[model samples]
Structures are given as structure tokens and as C-alpha cells.
Target chain A: MKFTYQINGAEHTLTLEKHPEGYRAHLGTAIYDVKLLHAKDGQLHFQLDETRHTAHLAHETPAKRWLHNAGRTLVIEKAATHRRGADTAGGSGRLTAPMPGQVRAVLVAVGNEVTAGQPLLLMEAMKMEIRIAAPHAGCITALHATEGGSVNKDDLLIEVEEIPT
Target chain B: MPQFDRVLIANRGEIAVRLIRACRELGLSPVAVYSEPDADALHVRLADGAVCLGPAAARESYLDMNKVIDAARQTGAQAIHPGYGFLSENAEFARRIINAGLVFIGPPPEAIEAMGDKAAARTRMQSSGVPVVPGAQDLADDTKIQQAAATIGYPLLIKAAAGGGGKGMRIVHSAADLLEGAAAARREALHAFGDDRLILEKYLTDARHIEIQILADQHGQTLHLFERECSVQRRHQKVIEEAPSPLVDESLRAKMGAAAVAAAKTVGYTNAGTVEFIVDPVTRDFYFLEMNTRLQVEHPITEAISGLDLVHWQFRIAAGEALPFQQADLTPRGHAIECRLYAEDPANGFLPATGTLLKFSTPPGPGIRVDSGVESGSVISPHYDPLLAKIIVHAADRTAALQRMQTTLQDTLALGLTTNLDFLQAILAHPVFVAGEATTHFIDQHLPNWQPAPDIPAAAIIAAALAELHSPSATTHTTASPSQDPHSPWLRLTGFRMGGGE
Candidate 1:
């Protein structure tokens, strides 16, 4: 089916395909290996695996595109896609690293106003200094890291409440 | 030689797996050693047999000399090959292995001890007319030290007697910073190498870190396997090493090779080892940096260029074999580059980070060889080097190899932990690195600070966005919307899914 679409502020026609497994989408001339997990109201969450990583793409029906590849072909319908259980995530404690690095300077003052991308702390992982930007605009209700700290994969940095801006 | 049929590797991670490959190719029975953390490591599965070495702490396992020797003895092994770092260069350990009547598979104890002492090696090289660096006499008083530095030149280096890595090294431009720099060097030296004694030398900026690999036998025949450029470093530790350096031409290669041979012969060097040199780019002149009497991390580039296996050569030479490939017959054919894929965040100051491999996948194509120590499910704990793999690319020229590396880096992906992926991408993208204008200060001179590219690749954004939601252990986001849209949310959600509030 052809649908009038606007992504990244560009108007285009997208071809949506229904397959034996999931929906195949060809949007903006690029093939999207898109997988839908849970669709509630106007929100549709999907996963995208291009080459190496399988990305869970949160695709809102009335979506916003941050970028559009110039002179690039999109074949979302032709891209290989798969569906994984949305409930597959069976655990808790969702603290993610602000960025990849060794925790050098974690300025977690317990509770603080951490706007989305707020500079929560600093880390030196690959001989470079990078400020740990807050994942979302939130009130940091809990601080997980300390100054002069060492954190491993998925180790907590800080806990923030996702209060609407 | 005390002989055994099988040898158990007393380490986990990459070097252990590398050793297992060497052992299997050499027709020796291989045994895997694991910590509680590495029972699922790639090395354990690859080995013919596996034994739990001990807990995850290296000091209790890999660095535990007694435990290592005991594992070797218990597994009925003839020798222990300390593959570089963790106890590979330790002289005391080598001596103990010798006293235990087990082959060390490296240079003699005397060579390790001699090179271990930077003072003695400098003295020996100087005596042998190896064109030693001009430095102060050992440990002069404050005034005498100033006088010595003044005599040497305005910009002189106060290098630690036990220095190998960039630690314990101080560059004094004038007499003003002499005392403080000296004290700092001494403290770092004492901490790193147990020896606070330092010698002075001229500090040459814009130098290339090139080194020649030498294989000397007990029969007095020593040959060079060409050189590798390793100037790309962070915190004095070499992060990337490449062979047939883009800087050195044929004539320069010969001169550097000869000097390396001379340095090795001066100390009666043998086995698979590297003689490091700090080479001036403009003058094409070089100086002896130090000797690493063990396998280098980037030996694959050497192996690719020379078409000779240094590790196999090591075993053969240790097993009373002569240098199989003559120096005259060996010549580098192509330009090769190796980027060490460390488990650190380059956005940060390259501090080491540890994590379990969630989704480890490499770029698949030609002209690329990945020397990986861990796999998709391996755990990279804080107990060892954060280097997960060495992504090596070979091509007809340096440009092709570099392009291949950039493509490979873009294509590769790892979930669950952060890495220096973007940092490496930035370095390779630099005009200087592309122009083959690499130096010891390449990182400093070019990228003193990290900046996020305004235009990140479409693939990366998509991957990051997709990763935010799809990654195995990620929290399910209700919507990928403007309010909670863009890929960074998936990144943010990675935290929320785990319920990591406290």
C-alpha cells in the first residue's frame, strides 16, 4: 500500500508491505529492516538490524525523522526484518552509561535537576574527556556513580525521573 | 628440557587464545585456564583441555607466578609463553621458569634482566657504539643534574632507568622545570618499575614510533622481520601499531633494520622480539627506545607484510631451529595498519571500562583480519587490559588499508558497553592520519579534544536508535516519538529498562 509520508520534513510516498511474519516498509527510498514489537494507540515500537546491531526502533506513526540521507535509496520493504517479544526484557534496573568511557569524574550530587542531555559527570575512557550527558530531561532522584570511579558495562551512572519538560 | 605433552594457559582473554592457536599449530596439547568470570571465555572452548586457574583477579591467576608455573607443571607442559604484558616481560618470572627446568619460550634470563634495566641497556648499547642518546650521567646532584641537562641541550629528556612505557618519562625544556619534573619522573618510575634512577637525553618532537622485529637463534644468526610504527599512543601506552611504516622508505628501512640488528647482537638477543626506535621524520634518523623481549600486540601486521609467522618462528627457534626465513628473502609487500579495539570510551579520557559482550559482531570483508580475544558473550571485567580485539587491515598501500579500517569500524558493533569506536573513527578521518603524517603526538597535535560530528552517519544514528530499543537487554520504550523519539532515547531507555534507579 502507498501512503503519503513526511519524514525529516521531506514529503514522500512510502510502500508498506505485509509479510508472513511482520510489516515491511520502504520509506524515503531506503530499505528498512523494521520489526514491530508493541503498538499502542498512535505509538508503534519496532526493531531495526542493518548490519551488526539489531536496533529497537521506536517508530511513532506520526513520527519525526532526525535525519534523511541525501541521494540515498530507501527500501524498507526489502530490508530483512524480524519480530522479538516486547516482553522479552524480563528484568529491571535500567541504568545505561551516558557514553562509552572510563568513569573519571562522576558529579552525582545525589538528587539534582538533570535535564535531558544534562552534564551529569565526566569520564575518561579512551584517553579523552567526555561529559556524561543525561539520557533524558529528568530530575535525578538517585546518583549511582562516585567521583574518581570505575564503571563497567551497563553499570549505573545516575538515576533520574523523566518529568515532562 | 623438562617436557610435557600439554600446556595449560594460566590466563584468559586474547593473549591466552592467541597462545592456544600457537600451541595447536605447533602440535602441542593445549589446556585452557579460566577465572570464575571467564569460564565461558573463547580461550577455554578453543583449548584441548581447560582448568580453572583461580578467581578473576589477575594477580591471583595470570600474574601469580607460582600458580602459573604450577599449572604448567600440572598440565605436563614443557614451557610457558608469557605473551607480552601480564608477566611476559618480567625477568624474575623468566628466571624462575628456568630454575624450574621448564623452557620459557622467550629470550634468556640475562637478556630480560639487561633490557629490564634501562640504565644497563643504555650503557651496553653506548659501549657497543649503537649511537646512544646524549643524557646526563646516572643520578647526579641537583646542581650537577642541571649542569648535565644544560650540557646535553636546552630540551632534554629525563627517562627512568626502568622505563619502557611512556610512564616515568619527563621532558624538561629548561632548567626551570628540572626539579619538579625529575621528582615526578622518579615517583612514577619507582611506582612503575621499582627503580627511581633516571638518565637524561635529548627530547625529539615529531618522531615516529617504529620498531624492527628480530628473530635470533642460539646459532648466532639474527635476522630482522622489518619494522612497525607504534607512535599512536594514549597515556604513554601504545594503542595502535602498524608494519612497514608509511614514513620509512627503502633506504631508511635498511638503515633502521641494520641498527636494530646491531642493538640485538650487542646483547646477544634471541627469539621473537621487537627493538623499538623513535625515528625523526625529517632527518629519517632513529634512536633505540627499548627492547620488548616478547611478542608484540600488533605482530599480525608484521606476519602479513613478511608472510612469516613470528609465533611459529618463536617455537621453532626455541625448539633449536634456525631462522627459517632469511632477512634477504623477507621484504614487506604491502602497507598494513592495526587499530586496537579497546573496551574504553573515547568520548571520555580513554579510561578503561569493563563489561560483558552483549552483541559483538565485526565487519565482514576482504583485506581485513581481526585478532580477537573475546567473543559475543565474553565478559570484559576490570581485571585486565580493556583491549577486546585488534582490527587489522592490509592493502596495496596505506590509503587503502586506512579506508578499509574506517569502513570496518563503521560496520562493526558492540552492545551492552561503551567503546572508543567513535574516537578511532575520528582519528582515522583526520587529514594528517590520511596523509600518513603520524607522530608520537598525532593525537595531541590533531585532536586535543573530542567533538561530536554534526553530521553523524545515517547508519550510526539508525544503529544507535535501533540499539536503544532492540538490544537484547534494553528496556522497551512505549513510543519512538518526538517527546520520546530520536535514537538517543533507546540509549536512555537502556538505563530505564534495567530499573537502575539507585
Candidate 2:
């Protein structure tokens, strides 16, 4: 599968695949052999090695460096995440979850005018505290998800109508 | 042997991400293994492939070696790199890897076995003129221990022979403290190292913990890669590490290097390893402690100073290649220091805390190198080592290195999750630390409520409030009346950098 992330307002495509060693990512790929066990609050976990990292990763997500692409705003992700010199679209933008979280605070009413990189709302996944920033100048034309709702991979929270001129 | 085009990292967090980079450098495809909790992990998204291993508890996932090896086979992986503190040091697991015909990128099982038992290694080193500390010959037999104590003198250390990291060890200042200390050491040794056999050693006060890096190829060219001063520690666990120890003059370095070489040679070692020693600061005398028969957590510091690729060399040596560099060619350059980033509260006695990472940041500048295993949206649990990342700084001199460290820490931020940030900051500012006079007991001597000084006062609390106010994810957004609810919904924002994610 592929994901498009914006860096400083430039959209970069990322290709993510399922792990061969039994990993299944909803947005990426499905891996066989690895199993997922359910936990408290319907949380699923997986252990990778014959040690504790898997568990640590499950409970402690942000501490894992591998998940951090450590690059520009638009990280391609994956081994191919090293794409440089890619063209930046003039009118492209994105609004991603600021923190790995669910949408908890959607203060914007649709069709509201907003500047580039303006604050949209709050994403509340993983106890992650991020003020989702607008990717480009636009009007809040559509509300994709509702406040006080749970969302997953690629769940659209809100849509912006690109403002011409 | 079938070559696997891609090898999946069967873990999450910073180590997993670090391994993925290493695999990329090694020309192998990396598969990221993650739990449902880590769906957003950087390693998983970055690897060529990803797999869900199991649930969050260690027993079901990372410790599930079968699933891991099977994942490798399923991914058509030819080898697996077990990063430290996980399956990286498990000898039985290594045997299993060999039994299954998958390359385990670590030392041979026999070598691991030899050194795993601290007592056994002590015996081997003693015979090889490795100058081990004087201690009891075996687990304390009441009578034998009494005699050994009388012979070895007072102020002895009862340690688990097969232990590493300060687990299963105790200091006995007198005969009155002997039996209890012995029991504590024995029990801890049994649990941590799975070996109950222990020995007593003469405890030297104010000893600078130092170790020499060594690399051995299959053809027997074992080279010493100088020494690292790991004197800064807390509870016997190393906290800060630097190469070409400040206290080690040329003569001391030469002597210690020779001893480390002898120790590795005697063991017929064939991989990147570390031989630890206790150097008495007052007299400048040193004694052999133990040998770690694998790459160390502090290897990057050694690499920073020596300009060597220990991991890449491990892979090369495993591939049956002659060491590319000769012993005479190896030399260290500028000084380097490493501080471990852990998820614990020093104010709360370093108690480990688990939560989703709210913010993560790291400093990026010249002479700063960082190795981490976690990212944003990642959760911290109590299932593994509390360490989250390692921040290393290199500079032309010790003073510059110290300054560099302070700068790096100031720029780094770990928000949401509790961490030892304050502890590390306190350690950096310690009087003894400033003067370059540190020992393993450094943390014990100077920590009660270790905290990092914010560039401004009330920075943490105010930032939390501002972040909550501006946060797009704040569910309650009750920064105003945090006292209203029991949860005390305080919003946490880490600095905008790569090193601050806790």
C-alpha cells in the first residue's frame, strides 16, 4: 500500500508493505506466521523477538526509533523512504493526525475559512497530544469524522477546499 | 544456505529501528515486526516488510523465539540480528538459530556460554593471566566462604558468576554482612543470568569502571579497540560511557589494552566484545571484571572515538572474512560520551512508567549521534528494559564533549511519558562529573530528585498547558480545570525534535 504525506506542504508518496515475518498492518501489508493476541481494552499486541522488545514496542510505541523515519515532513517511509529530489506539487496539501491518536476535539465547523497550516483540531490516539495543523491554505469544506469518535489508519478527519488565489 | 532477500526486524522501539538501518547497510531487506500497539512504529513503516508478532507482554511476543525464527524463514531471511538486551545475548536461542540453519549475528554459543558464567570466566581468565579480582572460588559453602573471606580479606563482593549488568551482586563490608549479601547476590544471579554459582571479590572503593573493545575474526586476528571509561553508573548499571578514558594515561591504557587482548585471546574469542575492569582512582590500579562476548550497548562511543564499525565488522567476520584492519592500525581519536535515555521517573526513585508517547524529540547538530528504538504514537510498557534511546556526543576534547552533552540534552525533550531526563541532566551537572572524577556509584551518591533545568522556569508545566490549549488531540482539553477530574488531564508537549519521544 502507499501513503502520501506532506512535508513543509510538499506531498511525498510512501510505499509500505506487509512484513514477511508474520506482521499485519492495516494500511501497509499483511504478514503471515506472526500472531496477534488481544489485550485489555481490545488492544492487540505482537512480540517480534524471543525477548521483550515486542512487548515494549506494543506498550511503548513512540520510544521505538524504527517507527520514526527521522527525515523531512514528507517521509516516504520504508527502505524506499529515501526519495529525494521529488517534485513538490504546487497546490497539494494534507491534514494528518498530529499525534498517533483518535479525533477528540473537532472545533472547526465545515466551510470555515482557515489559513495555511492553521490549527484544525485535536487527535487523541495513543495519548498522543498533537494539534493537527492544516497542510495548506483552504476552507474547512467537509468534516470527515466526528468528535468523540475512534478512528484508524487513513480515517479522514476533515477535508479542506483549496482556496485559489 | 538459502539467502534471504529480506530480514524482518522482530521487534519494535529504537533498537528495532536501529537494526533496520543496520540491515539496510548490510544489503539485506528488513521486515519490521510489530504488535498491534505499535502499528505506527517507525521501523514497521520503514522496513521492506512488517509482521505482527504477538501481544504486548514479553512472554507472548519478543520472547517467542519460535515465531521470530519462523518469521525469518517465512520472510526467506538468511540471518537475524538480535540487538542487545533482547534475544541478543541468549545462548540457548543462538543454538536454536544454528540448529535451524539461520545465521545468528552474534558470538558463537560456546563463547557466550564461557563468559555468561561470571565465575567460569573468572577461572578461565585467572589461568590466562587475565588478573581477575580475588574472590571466593565458588558459591558460598559456609565454611569455604569463611576461609575465603579470611584469605581474601574484608570488604569483599559477593557476585553471581554468570551475571552481567549489576544484577546478582552485593558488597560485603564485614563478616556480619556476608551471609545476607551472598544470599541476595545468589538469588539475583539465579533470576537474571539463570546461573546461581557466584564468587566473592575484593571490593575496591572508588574504582573507575572501564572496558576495552575487542574484535576477533574467524582467522584469529584479534585486535583491541582501546578502552572506554564507563565510571558513571547507578545501581551498577552503566549510564555514561566514553572512549580513551580520561583517567587512563598512556601507560594505563597500554596495560589495560594488553590485558583485554590477553583475555580475548585466551577465550579464543571471535567477534566484537568488551572486557570490563575496575580501575581504582586513588592508586590508578585496575582489576579485570568480566568479558561481554557480544557488541555492547556503548559500542557507538567506541566507534565514535576509534572510527570503527563494530556491527558491520560482526557481520563481515560472521561471513568468514579476514579482519580488514590490522591491530597496529587501530587508534582512537576525539573523545565521545553516551547517555542512556530511559522511561522512568527519577523523582519517584526511577520507577518505570508506561504510557503512549505524547511527544518525541532529539537534538540534531554537529558531533551528536543518537540511536533509538521508538517513535511518536509508540507506547512505553513495563515489559522490557526501561531504556528508550542512547544519546552520544563526540568532540575534540573532554571539556568540549561535556559541553556538547549539555547542549544536546537541553534540546531534547521526552513528553507525556515519564523518563529519566532529569536524572541524566543531574548527572551531567554533578560536581564530580564536571571535574571528570566519576565512579559506578555516581548515581547513588548524588541523586534524590534529579530534574533537567528548563531553559525557563515552569517550562514543563506551562508547556503542558499551552500544548493542551493548542493540541488537536486533547480529548478533555481541560487544562483550565485540571483539578476538576481525577485523571488531571494535563496536556504534555515534547520539544520539536527527534530525541524527546518518551
Candidate 3:
């Protein structure tokens, strides 16, 4: 079986085949004899080639794996099946919450015209106040976030229609 | 003199744990108060008794004077200890504790109020013969502000009168930006601290932030425990702190120490406090900044160098104990450095990151100390400060201390969340930091746009792949589960191993 993973915006491939003695693994252009020594409780002890390695499985999900090895932590994510469209190429015209936080204030109202780089909202997260700015000059078509309301990551907070220009 | 058999700690996280340890060592039972979300916190688990104050919002729980006092009353605690943040420096809280017939393990309420106001504190420091930064206050209108700006000249700083931690501060380098800067600063000050008053000061370029630790007793005996260099800062928040600054010689240390002692004595301060100063590196001239009426977060580095337990002394002083040693008997022995481990992304403008700590480990060795609040499986909530732990190392000299700090940070691992560990390592390796020439602008002047190394090692990739193949959620075609496949290599595995490859 073969698998593809992304780390730090770069992708790598790995293949594994069962063998009578252990397993044969192919990573990038290198092949190595791999044997699992132990695996339990989010800990994996394996021998790759002639070196023994132990990696702690910090977190695991269907699309991501967080591993800790050699005093460094790395996050490996499965390549998304469908790439996101270039919504941010020019401007998305739709603003979403970048992280979970509370809306401290709403500086703009519906139907109000805003210029690119102008602050439209204020948010409080992690004990710091963050200013949410307009991605492009546009007319506010909808406002979904209310003052003092909590929001989740990627939740749409505002929708704007670009002024014809 | 007041004697207490039980003490209630009105704080959470690492500092609370530190105080609890102190209370236990002093033969007093320690009680803990926590919010709803912090019921399972390490501090609560380690305390002799625990109470639920209120909800998770600090305003309703940790910062609520009524709730905290009630918790202490219900727990039968005779004294209350407020750690660094929260209500530690609130004068009203201390007053209420005293009115409730409970001892407040900190300075008197009068001292807290005296130094809590930055503008008022500056005036007092000047009257007490302590050198203060050239600035003007009590500007009630635009005309007064303009005049003050003219007197202070260009490149002045507009600061919030009721602020600390660098909030509501703006640096204006030209006269044209004075009014606008003051207005913006007022708005920020009102938003952050509920006060819109502003002050102007001459902005010093290339200054070092050195603070003296002062311990005072009720018997009018005060002593200074040397200095801690906290010049490495970002957005005015301290990142790394060290003891016995490399730039300070015997003569300079004596001057600063005496100034700090005088500042504390003027405020009638008792217990452990810090007097922060802004020193010009070229002339070695220092100006009084402010006096913190409570224990500071970086007290561990002072303890490392002075070989004195500050928390223990705080308890003793609050109990009306007298000093056991004279000023001539105390002297710093070695160098110490501390690196704060925060749950924030240095690559992304230092935005705080929140997640569960799936794997948490601290390095263990000689001359190393880890003061942490979280463990494996702990959740990192966004409701409070992002500080996770502090890694401090002590050695014979500055060079050896820096080397030990680098090794210690490399050995510490905190996964499932973004951290400043890599950024701290980069700072330790920087030539400017190595030469001990770093000023308060080190992060901005030297490493303004630091990013983590982009290359991922082959070993990490292999480990990730193998872990995924063995995960229970993996597809049956790729998974080699011992339950489903008896001939799988996982079934042949026997003993467990730890750590990385040699």
C-alpha cells in the first residue's frame, strides 16, 4: 500500500510491503528494511534500517498525525483530496473567523461601503484584541457576527459584494 | 503577629503550584480555588483542599474579590496568597482580605495603591530621590498635551496611566503624529484598562530592562537581591530573563541596588517586590520605571543566583518576621537564565494557539528547573495567559548558562500545539545574544521575521508513515493490526522503547 503526506507545505510518498521476516518500506527514493518492535498507547518503537527510533504519537485524526521524535514535534497531514480554489487570489469578498474567538465589536453595518485594508470588526482571542480588516473594497451585503458573540474557526462572519471597478 | 494554619491560594497555573509547595514546606495546609474549567488543574490536584469559585471567565471567578474571599472563608483558611497575575496587585482585594480578618500574603494595601498608578508612582519616585524618565503627566486637554509634547521633544512615547504589560503604548518619532498618537493611545487605554488617561515620556533607544528584587520586613529592614536583565522582549512582553547582567560590574550593581531599595522604602513595601529600571547601555545611567507590589513571574532566576527561596521569604515577611541576615552577608554567586515557554506561534505574529497537550515532557538534569502547569492530556484554553512553563538554568558564568539553556530547550518537547520553543533556540544561537549585547530591541532589530526551518527530516517522515499504517482508523488494506492479522510484524513486537535514535 502507498500513502501520501504533507509536511510544512511539502508532500512526500511512502510505500510498504509485507515480508516474511518483517516489512520492506520505500520512502522517496530510498528503500529500507523495517520491523515494528512495539506499538501501544500512542508510542511507536520501530527499527528502520540499522537504527532504532521511537516516536510518540501526540495526536491522530483521519486527516492528520502529530508525532514527536528527537525532541522535536512535527505535524503530518494527509494531502487534501480536492485543492481549495483560489478564493484569496484577488479577494474572497467573504470574511471568516481565522480562529475561535469572541467578537468584541462590529465597526461596519450592512450596506456600508468599505475600502480594502479597512478594519470592519474587532475580535478578542487569547487575551489579545485582533482587528479584522476588509480583504477588498466592497459593499457589505450581510453581517453574521454580533457584538460579544462567540465564533468557531472558519465560521463566516461577513459577506461583501465587490464594487464594480 | 498573625499566625495561619491554612492558606488559600487565589490563583491558578504554575505560580499557584509554586505557592502551594511553599505553603506545604512551611508546615501550613494549602487550599486551592479554581474556576469550573480548572477543576482538574494540577494546582487543584496538589492542594490539601479545593473550592470552586465560579465560571471560567476570570472576571467572574479568579478576579472576583467576593468569590475568592468567600472561598477562603468557607475553606477555613486564615490567609490568602495571590500569585503574580489576576488580583495579585489589586489594592481593593488586599483591603477586603484584611477587613475579612484574613492575612494577605503580600504588601500592605496602601503600598499597592501607591505604586499601582504609573503616573502617581513616577511622581513619588522623583520625590524620593530616585531618577525617573523625563515625562509629563496630568494633561487634561489638547493644549496641555501639545505643550507637554513640545517639552519632551519628538520621538516620545505615549503611555497609558493605568497600564502595564505594554498595552496602550505608542511611539511617535515626529511632531506631526503627536495628537493622533495620543488619541489612539487613549482609545486603547480605555478599551484595555477602562481608563483613557495618557502620559508622555522621552523614548530611550537601545535601553536595557534591568529590575532589582527587593525584600522588606515589617521591622524596617530592606535589602536588594541584585538584578535580572529582561531586555529580550516582544511587544513589551518579556521573553527571556537572566540574573547578574553581563554588563553590570560591582560599582554599577551597587548603585542600582541602592536606588531600588530606596524606591521600596518610600512605598512602605513589605514582602517580595520588583523595581524595574530602564538603563542606557552606553552611559550606564538607569531610571526608575515602576515598582511591582507583588511577586514577579521571573523570580525563579533571582532565586537561582542568590540561593534564596523568595516564596519562602514572602511567607515569612508577611508573618511579621524580621530579617535574619545583614546586607553585607548577601551576595550573588553565579549566573542564571530563564526561557519562558509559551503556547503561541512565533512564525505567525505570536498569535496564541489552543489545543490539547497530547505529549508533554520536560528535560531533567543538574542545574535545570521546570516550573510547569500542564501535563500530557491537558487542554490549552484561550481564556487566560498562554504561558505553559518556564525553563531556568544556572551555571558558573554567562557563557555556560547560555549553553545549558540551549541544551535544555532542545530536550523539552510540547506537542499538539504551537510554541515558541524553536524561536527561543534561535535567539540563544544568535551572535548578538551570545555576546550579551542584547537590548530591549533585540527581537525587533535582529530577528524581526523569524520562521521555523522548512526542512523536515526523513526520520520524522518514516515515523509518521509507520504510525499511520498501524492506526486503527486506517484502511484495512494498509493497516497491519495484530488483532486482524496474526502474521503482522506488529504482533512480533515485544518490548517497548523510548526516546529517539542514537
Assess every candidate by TM-score. Answer: 0.72, 0.70, 0.80
Residue runs of model 3 more than 4 Å from their true location after superposition: A16-26, A29-54, A80-165, B190-195, B469-502
Tens digits of per-residue lDDT, candidate 1, A62-149, equal 1221111221111111111122222122112125564556554444332234556656665656655566676666544445565445
lDDT, candidate 2, at B98: 83
Q: For model 1, what fraction of the real interface contacts is kept?
A: 0.03
Q: Encode model 3's per-residue lDDT on B1-502: one tens digit a residue.
A: 3588899999999999999998989998999999999999999999999999889899999999999999999999999999998999999999999999999999999999988888888889899899988898788998999999899887899999899878889999998999999999999999998998888998998999999999999999999999999999987889999999988899999999999999999999999999999999999999998898899999999999889999999989988899899779999988999999999998899999998876678878889998888997788899999999999999999989999999888778787788898899999999999998999999999999998778776667777766655542211111112223466332332121111110
Q: Write the per-residue lDDT of candidate 3 for residues A1-165, one digit (tens) a residue.
A: 455678878898777677775678888788988887877766778888889987776543335657767656677786643213335522487788888997765655443567898777767677666777888887665567866689988887776667555
Model 1 lDDT tens row, B338-429 = 88888886656887877555445676788898888877546678877898988889888787888888888776755445677667878888
Q: DockQ scores for all the models shown?
A: 0.05, 0.02, 0.12
Query: What order do you get sorting by DockQ, best first?
Result: 3, 1, 2
Cα misplacement distance, residue A97 of candidate 2 (Å):
29
Candidate 3 scores a C-alpha RMSD against the true structure in Å of 14.6
- What shift in Å separates residue B204 of candidate 3 from its native position after superposition? 1.7
lDDT for model 1 comes to 0.68
